[model samples]
Target: MSKTEKISELKTNKTRKVAFMFNDELWQLFKQTCETNKTKPTWEIEKWILNYLDKNNALD
Candidate 1:
């Protein structure tokens, strides 16, 4: 198989780590919003980042 095919066939069971810092009030608000929506803040953030990347064509 070619490099592109090999790369495409690759799968990972690993997860990446990331960190962020924000205002205490903003964090509280974010937590509350996630709880009210019955979802996790991390999940919401991941969805938001994916949407943003897709909109900007950053994934390409």
Candidate 2:
């Protein structure tokens, strides 16, 4: 398969939605962390949560 085909296959293989509640203070902290790390706040938070789950073997 072509690179695009492979990527598309991967994208279609799985999906999930994660929702949570956070106060303003927590959101500010997350935004600051993302800025300090030079990453988009939303993307960084999602990545962090995913990594945490993976490390804890909770992705099942």
Candidate 3:
């Protein structure tokens, strides 16, 4: 898909809420990293979780 389509999909699909506790300094760092990558922190965290699951063969 094109980048615009993907961005629209992300915007439309962010209808759910996920809550977690994040440390002050660490959360700031994560926010900066997400800004650097031009993505939301939630998306980055989702990618991290998916990668871990895939690497551990736990995606099934």
Best by lDDT: 3
Off by over 4 Å in 3: 1-16
Q: What lDDT score is found at residue 33 in candidate 3?
A: 88
Candidate 1 clash figure, as a count: 0
Rank list by lDDT: 3, 1, 2
State the RMSD for candidate 1: 5.5
lDDT of 1 at 14: 26
Best by TM-score: 1
Spell out the clash pairs found in candidate 2: none
> Which lDDT tens digits does candidate 3 get at residues 1-60?
654565456556767787899899999998998899899987777778667765786554
lDDT of 1 by residue, 1-60 (tens): 654453343322226777899999999999999999999998788768657765786555
Over the stretch 1-60, how does candidate 2's per-residue lDDT look in tens digits? 654564455446657766778998988888888889889876766567567765786554
Cα lDDT for residue 18, model 2?
68
TM-score of predicted model 2? 0.46
Off by over 4 Å in 2: 1-19, 56-60
